[model samples]
Target: MPETVFEVDVDEDPEDQPDPIVNRWHPDTPPAATIKPGEKVRIECLDWTGGQVNNDDSANDIRDMELSPNHHLSGPFEVKGAEPGDMLVVDILDLGPFPDHEWGFTGIFDLENGGGFLTDHFPEARKTIWELDGVMTHSRHIDDVRFPGCAHPGIIGTAPSHELLEAWNEREQALIDRGPDAQTGVNHETGDDEPPLALPPEPENVLLGDMDDDKLEDAAKEAARTIPPRENAGNCDIKNLGRGSRVYLPVFVEGANFITGDLHFSQGDGEITFCGAIEMAGYIDLKVDIIKNGVEKMGTDHAMFKPGYQDPDFSDYLVFEGYSVDEDGTQHYKNGNVGMRRACLDAIDYLTNFGYTREQGYFLLSTVPIESRLAGVVDLPNTCVTVSVPNEAFDINIDPDTLADDSVVTDRSDVAKPS
Candidate 1:
């Protein structure tokens, strides 16, 4: 009550109690907790796969990977010793870094690795390498651009029902073994090693022969119009994560099922690569606590992202979480656009380091044609939103070495090519 503490996701109904927060899972419903202010909890968000594999990851290993469809969340923990109608506070104080870099390759969205705009097109022929350091090194054709990998939980939410969980587990496994996916070699043998989810071993990207090669190309290209960037657009790596940043999330179901994986060496705003650097497993330390409602007050149950903002001229990097992608995935894109606005606010603040004023930065962002991206969707449990700004637009003016603790914004001036 008087000091900071850590807790887990507890259950309570808002409408039946005092204040209410529209639950994310059951939108028409009310939230369980009415959390109090200044109450914060640390989260130990596990890397996706629940530590199923790590830096020592390998294709052969993936083919043999055995994680019983566990979304691998730290916990949908219950905040005991408390009542309902309160707020659940979470702080992104620290993150675990991947020690090994061998398996820490940048993941591209092709049917091969399960990413890429035309990924489904060349699902069997798309892959890229990445450098897991300060100057995120990557190549596109002959040109290359650099960005930082600011990571977060692609799937963070409350625990789902038994049926939902079971279905997701099956889906996750299917993707990994759907064809020659997690295999080691580039495009080795057929599904002899990894079989399809259901259908027989048909040609690559020729499911049902509905869309021919030409039609597939058109579809891939059209899909590219909205697919997360890659060769079609290349990776949209951003550099907001070098230090000091905090991320907050609302807990819907019990045990706030938090699944953090899909590590990237470095990623731009749009996540064009459809993945991040270092697709290997890693650890994230976070704390989850439930804040009762009637006993507390909250402006909103949404997240308070850290590294607060980025360059205004750059595209907005947005983050979102919600329901099925099939029904409103594109609408989910709309959600990302909103996050972009918040990014603009942060970008304005970031520009301050480069001698740009709130007004000046805002002006630039208003004129900027920000790009949108779909970061990832893990099972039926959780999803993501991505907004990327071009790095070439603004100047990173601050020295990274002297960054202070109070603010998430950084001065880009000190980002020398990692030595």
Candidate 2:
């Protein structure tokens, strides 16, 4: 079948705007456009800061910007045949910066806010500007490094129905109800300052007083936020989902109301620092299809995926190990957040010894393609976590094509090994 193409650009104009950029991913957010199941879509997205942090923005600008309701998305493009319980197959065909602007930024969250992985060690907020050249990215802060870009939409998912939305809130709220002292292990901070675990009350859609059922329904629709990745897969920031990747998201609402944004030029796993990754404003070319009765057939609750990468370079990595246990013999292994934080701190410590400042090391860790893995969860006293940074990303003179050989090992062979 001949594929139909639809375009949804960022509405920067003051008047006559047909399509608008939406910051929240509520089910009621009207579709910017609609297309058949087999059609293609070219969506233009703003950066995670929604144009607030420009290429020339300073660290203070990043610190001052209102980051709530972030991940400025382009569309909730309705798939003509998609319905609840079906699966939306999104084939990411292409992704990159917009033609006119080929630059992006990376930064770390402040300490006062929900601190980053290495917040206690590197507490200050910082920003780095990255210049994009096709599939390569170079940052002025780290002049000695340049790596091949792996651009992808950090946030991509379908809107949740009212029932599913309520379930998400209730579950998340239950976790929040277990006070900070409770060992819930999940990151409860949803980037909002409201009560009941940052899950804000739904905004009243249009005060339709004197109404009964419609008013309640409107309030329910406004409850879904864009922060957490639920069964509908709102912000699953998996870095490997580049072009040619296929994402399968369980549909909860009719038409699916598929939306995407938070395009990153490059990022590491875990995004340990809240603002980690080269945040970019770019265009995504996607081909969407639907699988009928996908929930029952796939046997999955939320979104699953087959990631694709163009010419993936498999080089040796400088692995840094960490353990989430105190010297007093306490283990925190329920959610893996504590383990991940320790891993990032270890990576930063290793980088500092290589002549980089603590801040520089933290920024580099955030921007580079570092992979954080749970090395051992079954260990009784401590949960082991490993942060692996690719060796090729360093400035050391090495052949890119030959770096994948097993004989080539990272320089830090003498570092403390994981038990």
Candidate 3:
């Protein structure tokens, strides 16, 4: 393990500070701290909601929480030798709860706001608290279910370049303009056409240190909200990025301006229900390095440049399958997002059959270390997606014999002799 050179305490206050943590990632936002590559920095991070939710298990705190400038990121730690077009390799050296505060949360967002996987089916706002012990976590809301603690930073990324920020906003706005009905593939009889929420405009005069005149432009300072992950790797809620994992993120600005927050004590893949994922305040020790011209030298495409992890811990899985087709057998292969959504819903439904209610099933799917995998994409009419839950996490006997057969007959014997 590398020795820590710098530390950020999340609870420190500057005598009535307006915002405790930097809320946006931009090149113009001056680096909070700078450390050379290979030097380790330990950051004390707040949960996704900052400090709004307390240990009292308050659901209203989550429901009434402000959404703007969300995911309180710790630092835009400038790597000494890093520059644009390089690959920032962040080693997940260590993760754990902040001193004396061993707790976290999981929940589902209301449908009227930004909805989640099963928003239409389960639209109520809910929350579940998890108590984190040494290497295990147990929730009182969901009885008789406990899992090992797998902690990691949920939001980790570098700031996007000025041009990349514009491109992101333009593309995301186009998708939002398509309206909920068009995107979800469900027709509304009443035609309630609500425009998608616009990305908050970037703040002005936020520059904290000496900056070049060009870098201070409005366009240069502004960036798209950190909701979706892109080539720059912001808000990628991957569960496998725990201790010992190495994540490579493409750098678009000088210093790679690395930032991280939204610490999760444990989270499942897909993060189906948005609100909750064992959210926690913790410390993460990251060892950073830079790979120069990684994009061109590696021939990496845009989508492939997001973030790649290595040497993740693996386990046996109890898998559930979902297809992107209607009950009447109509296939909808065009939209893969909707397909993945259906797969998540199916996984939650399968959990319900095992005595978990619809809400509990959603909560279990979010907090546990489950993974969502695209099983098959080439199947003609219907695309297959599978949610794999680690069998080791639970003590209950989920018999493989009782589950539905996921095998597909590939025999071509019935093809009529080529006419």
Best by TM-score: 2
Ten-residue region with minimum lDDT total, candidate 3 = 410-419
Q: List the residue pairs that clash in candidate 3.
A: 107-276
- For candidate 2, give the lDDT of residue 361: 66
Off by over 4 Å in 3: 1-20, 180-190, 193-221, 301-316, 327-330, 400-419
Tell me, by lDDT, which candidate is best: 2
lDDT of 3 by residue, 303-332 (tens): 222222432254777777777775455778
Q: Work out the TM-score per prediction.
A: 0.40, 0.82, 0.82
Q: Which 10-residue window of candidate 1 scores lowest in summed lDDT?
A: 224-233
Cα displacement (angstroms), candidate 3, residue 256, comes to: 1.4
Ranking by TM-score: 2, 3, 1
In terms of lDDT, model 3 sits at 0.68
